[model samples]
Target: MQLPIKKTIDSVPGGMMIVPLTIGCLINTFAPDTAGFFGSFTGALFNGALPILAVFYVCMGSTISFKTLPRVAGKGGVLLGSKILMGILCGVVLGHFLGEVPITSGWFAGLSTLAVVAAINDTNGGLYMALMGQYGTADEAAAYSVMSLESGPFLTMVTLGAAGLSAFPWQTLVGAILPLAAGIVIGNLDHKMRDFLSRATPVMIPFFAFALGASLDLHQVWQAGLLGLALGLFVLVVSGIVMLVADKTTGGNGVAGLAAASTAGNAAAVPTLVASANHAYAAAAAPATVLVAASVIVTSILTPPLTAWWARRVGAKAQL
Candidate 1:
């Protein structure tokens, strides 16, 4: 019998992403120290999710062109603005009521500013690009360049800062996407270089996904449980509606907008950064991180089918 593990994963909606991350999490949980054996190189490469993600961001950036900026900005701006609005909304509502800590009630224990903002702010850029490539145009996929600006904890920090929860260093905000900025510069300068690097964009997804998985402990997911699942659905419904409206307003049929609704895999890394930035978030960070990871998995699995279904509806209407 053939194992066909890759084929199996490729067959699922977000299988290519979800499968590797599942494997990485299992290895980290069971073997635990396996990442340390190879002179901690595995730790540096796989366990260090942020560094891996930074390189992946560069690859993603190289696919975008300055020539497409006008169209990309128009499309990307709406989605980005919608995401930012929802993120700030969630943060302000939670900060004002919950005060950045776990609510005294266990029912809301998994909810926190870090988890809420991170989940809402970041889009699954890889998934969006993939879906847009299938259902929309090249310009739609290229718009991910602007959306990618929401990659790290910077926006979450900004939202928190606005809510009076924490103050963030401006340099760290700029530092987060420096690789992406560099890639954009070089990509715009050389057509051949852009084409070469663009091919590598899809390859980087699973690579960085595995790295992201190493930081997760499955038990933490269990602790997050139902509430985390609810948060993911909440993101899909709320942000998904806003994006659909934005896409329609920007002369799109809503495919790209619905495609951008999911939480990004790298968002799991944000709570730690948030906690590091402000000691107040330290108590909630661990659980919030796990919750955000759960959101990533849930959203990744859910968004593609939703986008496809929406695409079909739009197509059917167009034919009518």
Candidate 2:
């Protein structure tokens, strides 16, 4: 008897990314040493999120045409700007009330401006692309080329610093977009190369999703507790609203904006990176990491369904 595995996975909204991710999380949380236990190729699959994502971005970039570059940049800028502005607003408000130190007591313990801004400032590029591919257009998906600038600790640092909290070097910013740039150059130069690379875009999703999930531990979500859940909800709701408005205003139906409201899986690393850069954040770093990780999982699970709903509400067609 054949199992209806693909059908089962596809039945869930964003299941293509979320189901594999959930599996990886379960494996990492329970075994914890599975990668080490199985070396070589097996291990690499468990730990190769960034490399796979780099290739995915290049493949995504190949689908964009030079003629649509302006529109892509325009849409991306609006979403990116809206996200950063929301982070800055939240950070400034929280910094005024909470200052640099995280709450150390009660139900809200470990909540900090650092955590909020970091979670809000960065969007999950992988999730956004996946949702856009399913529910949006090529220009919308290509919009990530500009938005990828938010990937690392750079935007988080900038947001926190604006709130009086912390450079990631200039090279860091360039390195983030290099893969997409390479793909753009190649694709523009050769249509055959563009078609070939574009085919790999969807295929790379599950691989990177599982790898990203392997980097997480569900225990961190538990350690973060209610406050972490609250943070995740806050990111989804607050950032989601602003981004939705931004997307619609920029000639979109709000799908891309809503799709972008989730936190990046790698965003959990920003807290420690920021703390290392400026000791002022050192005390809040550990707690912030936990909270951001929870945001990653929470947003990853929720953004897809919510984006799908919004897309349907606005009559956006699913390319898939």
Candidate 3:
């Protein structure tokens, strides 16, 4: 008999991402003490997300050819621009109307600039690449290089800063962009090197997803409750729509846009990182982190089938 984990992982749409992530969340939740064992190497391997993602970024970058740079940049740029623009809009509108402590208001009472912006600004690069690999071309998956720039809290910081809510160090921005840039430089220079590293992208995804998920606390899902569910829907519906339109406008079917719609798994950490960078958001950080984590789970589940449906629809139309 084969491992059930493998069967389950292979069965799901974004199973490579969802399965490890689910397992990580379970470990973090039920076996919280497990993190304390082995001098905590298991915890570190699962929780040290940024460094792992940096390596993953390099591998992803290696797959993109300099010859296809324009197309990759174009698609990635459109998705990135739409994500950032939506984030900025939310921040500015909320900041202008509700002030920095927007959570005190009714209905949208549980939300704040940090949580909302972070959730919106980032895209699930792993999920997007997976979806694109299934429903789109290799170049479309390569577009994640651009989308990956939105990985950390940089764009969230920028959105909030523009809204008069917070400020962050420029070095944080540089630190986030460097790995992908290094990968691109190396990948474009050597074909053999690119081919070798490109093979590593799919293989590294589950590890990255596991690491990302380990950083999450499932209890956050409970803490976020209905509001977290709403945020996930907002990302999928609102941001998804914008990306879908941007995709079509930039000469794509709707699949790439839908693929780009999910909130990144790492986004759960953005609120805490943002709080660390700026004291202003410190009070909101804990709850915001939980809420964003919930959003990650929600988006991860929803985006894949939506992309597949759109892909099938587009394919049917083409056949017609």
| Number of the predicted model whose lDDT against the real structure is largest | 2
Colliding residue pairs in candidate 2: none
Ranking by TM-score: 1, 3, 2
Output candidate 3 Cα RMSD: 4.1
Measured against the true structure, the TM-scores of the candidates, in listed sequence, are 0.83, 0.68, 0.76
Query: With candidate 2 superimposed using the best TM-score fit, by how many Å does residue 125's alpha carbon deviate from the native?
Result: 1.2
lDDT against the true structure, each candidate: 0.78, 0.80, 0.75
Off by over 4 Å in 2: 1-69, 167-221
Please provide, for model 1 over 1-320, each residue's C-alpha lDDT reduced to its tens digit, 9 standing for 90 to 100.
97987788777545655667667777777877777887456667666665656666677677767766676899998889889988888778888877777653567766787788888899988789888878888778888878877876777888887876767678866765577787787788887888887788667768766765666677766667898899889888888899999998989999899999999876776787677667888877767876777787788889989998999998823211
Error of 3 at 46 (Å): 6.0
- Rate residue 320 of model 1 by lDDT: 19
Look at candidate 1 and give me any clashing residue pairs: none
Q: Count the clashes in each prediction.
A: 0, 0, 0
After superposing candidate 3 on the true structure, give the runs of residues whose Cα lies further than 4 Å from its correct spot: 10-33, 37-40, 96-110, 125-145, 196-218, 251-255, 272-286, 304-320
lDDT-sorted candidate list, best first = 2, 1, 3
RMSD of each: 3.3, 5.1, 4.1
